[model samples]
Target: MMGWLWAVQVILFAAGTGLGMSDARRKSTEVRLPLWVRMLISLTLTAAAFALWRDDPASSSKEWIFWGMAWSFIGDLSMAGIIPWRHPMIGGMLTFAVAHVFYIAAFAAALHHEGLDLMNAGLAVVAVFYGLVLIAAWLLLIRNPDAPRLFNIGSLVYGLWIGAMASAAAAMAWSLGGALWLTAVGGLLFVVSDTIIGAAAIGGRLLRHQGYWVWLTYVAAQMCIVYAFTL
Candidate 1:
């Protein structure tokens, strides 16, 4: 039953992503049906994914992951509305922020179980490099004149938290001898998705179709994290 549920979850996510890409293509036409369809499918996918392992072992870690997905689903709903102010992007960010916190906890538990060794020079170097990149990106957002001050500030804080989550995933991967490579990659992709979405929100016209890429990476990131548990 679990295996079948996992398969269905992946299929739903893939279909939703494809529909989201189509929505991006037709967004200029003001037809939002595809976007709504995709959002609904994505929501179902997350729920199904959570149901797959709700009764499995490692209950504590799974509980955190489940809550992470639950928060993500709320974030998705917050982002789905046409009224931006009614469901502000900041609200979505907060929801996802909490979700990331849960994800970090789960990753930490996994790292603990596997025994972490972060004294490696290479891992330190990579972490520092990634930290620098996040700082630069945060500064860019902070300096964008077109964005409202509140948005700029909120985005900076949210970006930092997400970056920390990604760093934790990377550290876990390093400690586990590349065993959690998918989770690490997923974390990076989540950062990329949020960065693009933020840039577009701040009046980056070139990134207008950013939703397609954002959802693609975001959904894949969640799926990767889910798969990592079975590894």
Candidate 2:
């Protein structure tokens, strides 16, 4: 039954991905899952995170992911506008940023075992790498002052944090190649997912099939991260 639980999660994620892609593929679709149902499918994130606790909740790294994923679930609802907050978008942004903080901490913890020099070198590579991405977002969102800009202020800070998270995860992969590579992959996917979201939100509209790509990358990102640690 425990193993079956993971299978069920895969099923839910696949179903949710299909529904989301279908909805986003074309506006002319005669049928669609309600927005709330689509958002609820994200509960699988929480469930998978919970399963990670089977190893050792006392471990700081595991605990961080546990809480991080919990925040991510809330973020999903907030972004979907299912939460009753007056400013659900802001709430989602804040919650997901917090989630990244926890993930950064967890990733950093894992890399601490390696020498500080190696870890720092790896992180520096990504920090510098993501600067180009940051510059691009600024260029795109500059024209639309009215639209939400994830490149601005608090969102900018959040972007950097996730960049740092990516750096840490990459450092781990470099120093200890194996399942840690999945962590690196997950981190990169996260950055990609968020970049797509920021671009669309800043433009005030999703590009053709952009929503499908967003959900697909986001789900895959979380799954990779979870599976990396669990492995």
Candidate 3:
């Protein structure tokens, strides 16, 4: 089952996190570039996703997860400026948004696999709250004088994608319970990380080590989502 890959990922994740936290310490106003260490970690996760999907060749959800992770790897590269693009920042945002679409697909597939309905009173409440919060946050980001109009628009669009991903994961976890809760945790953590970035965009500068907050939560999010599924 390629279980040893988990150990490899763990080692890489720890190393990357340490480097990211160290690099983040001095970045006050600007977000740190997506460094090679982080990109290597992302690539490892993508490979892990593929291994998982290969293990469950019949599972549609696993297939979606693999694609999602692949797109995420591409997004990391785009953000790192390793990929050629006229505007790397916006390209990375849009690419990451596309990855969320695959995650939404994976959640939908998981729901179907579990024979659970996506619509329910409890999940509706959670979904509604997420929607309202996103709306308010989007308005705030767009109105910020410091952020460019294009960046604001991209953030709003990306925020909606992540919101949908979170809602889908929440519905799956709420219905299934148990280890699936990690998936929900991952989704929510992703929102937390992204929200920090958005807040920084609005306020110009965040507390010291802004990248540390963002990177730690984000890595946790990705780890939670992929491993929880195997569990």
TM-scores, in order shown? 0.81, 0.83, 0.87
Q: CA shift at 221, candidate 2, in angstroms?
A: 0.6
* Top candidate when judged by lDDT against the true structure: 3
Better of 2 and 3 by lDDT: 3
lDDT of candidates 1 onward, in order:
0.71, 0.71, 0.78
For each predicted model, how many residue pairs clash, with residues at least 3 apart or on different chains?
0, 0, 0
Report lDDT (Cα) of residue 148, candidate 1: 79
Off by over 4 Å in 3: 17-34, 139-143
Model 2 misplacement above 4 A: 1-5, 17-37, 113-119, 141-143, 148-151
Better of 2 and 3 by TM-score: 3
Tens digits of lDDT, candidate 1, 1-231:
556656765676666656655765766432223565556655655665576457575556666777888888878877776435453787798889999999888777776665654445534665686678777876664347667787878888888788777877777777774547888888898888888887777636435445566776787788777667666
Tens digits of per-residue lDDT, candidate 3, 68-135, equal: 88988898788678997787768788888888888878877888887877775546877787888887
Please write out the lDDT profile of model 2 over residues 35-134, one tens digit for every residue.
Answer: 6544655676677677676567666777778788889999988888778777676687789988888887777766664544335667778778876676
The Cα RMSD of model 1 versus the native structure comes to: 3.4
